[model samples]
Target: MSHILLCFTCFESFRLTARNRAVRLSSVGKIAEKPVIGILGGIGSGKSTIAAEFAKLGCKVIDADKIAHELLEEPPVRKKVVSLFGQAVLDSSGKIDRRKIAEVVFADDRMLASLNRIIHPLVLKRTQELIEQYRRQNQVKAIVLDMPLLVEVGWHKRCDKLIFVDCEQKIRQERAEKMGFDKKQIKIRENFQISLDNKASLADNTIENNSDFSAIAKQVTGIFSYIVDNG
Candidate 1:
């Protein structure tokens, strides 16, 4: 099969099982009018902060990380996860320990892909639902996707515009460190993703987040206005 066909096939095969509350991705509706913006950035590049800035401007943000966290709490999902990673990934209360899962996945590419295969389809289904809901709302100006693997999984094609959050490596490392990730851990996570340069090149816009919040707010406002006015 061709690359595109193979990609779809891979995604299709990863759909959540019936017992796990399957979400049929093929049935999700696309938003028709307002721009669907996707954020691209390296680890710790403040993509969520950028999405929050857009939220303040009336855009609905579809946060994949939040959705994933919620999904892991579902009993079916927890069972499936245990089957994949074993009970060792669970905490004392039998809740999935995100930190333990991260440790397992980040150290091995195959394990990471396996975990994503189980989660990505569900996230996409919920994301599309939110997008359709926001599209119908008069109060929503646009939709912002703050997904970590936006470009990696080809969701950038679903976006009306892509914004690359640019920040220095030093600053990014410092931020990641503050989030409990060391330099080695950060590098390992990034190693599995597309390079920062390639992600920036694929973007329609770039927002430098090397400075204060005011600067980011100013840039976000300008870009939001431009997308709304021009579209």
Candidate 2:
């Protein structure tokens, strides 16, 4: 009986050791992998265009806004949002009415914070899962996280390098209007976000998107080269 007890103890110890070793190996593997680059910009700042340019150069691009759209469809997220914002925010299909919610929260700081509190965690969780999935696939050397609220929500910590897309407010406003956004709505959305100067200050690099597409593409390519060389 004593011999059997000793053997069981030894087996348990060995199992724990194996688990620890596996965790260490996994962590080391992640450390050796390429760092992710994050791009931050305000609304109508052409962040998607910049991300597309990087994607064209064979870089993996993860758009956080796209992820947020997907998360809104998740049942758990939908339920939580309805609970917080009331049934009026939901459509007949039971999905959150994005425009309605935006109108309510964008004008009020407390409401916006409450909404973000519910959504941001889910978004971050999904983003991390995708990053891990891509890392396991090992198909891409780096990822570009096109997040509009990167600095606002303090998501910058997830990035190894940060780039801010800078554009004049007048140009951004004109672009927003051309995209069919109501002038008042554009102004309201712009008010909710941090200033461009503040975002640029936090970023490791800045790309001005007020110029032509070719000029913006050149800036993106140069930034990518710098990250690859320095990373």
TM-score quality measure for candidate 2: 0.78
User: 54, model 1: CA deviation in Å?
Assistant: 0.4
lDDT accuracy of residue 172 in candidate 2 = 78
Per-residue C-alpha lDDT of model 1 across residues 1-231, encoded as one tens digit per residue: 010000110122221233211122222244346889999998889998999999999999998878888888898888888999999989999898888888887776677678878877887899899999989999889999988878766677678788999999999889878877877778777776677887887676999999999999999999999888877
- Considering summed lDDT, which 10 consecutive residues are worst modelled in model 1? 1-10
- Which structure among the candidates has the greatest TM-score? 1
Please write out the lDDT profile of model 2 over residues 130-210, one tens digit for every residue.
Answer: 888777765687787876666555556567777888888888778767665777887676665666666666577899998
TM-score of each: 0.85, 0.78
Distance from true position, residue 186, model 1, in Å?
Answer: 0.3
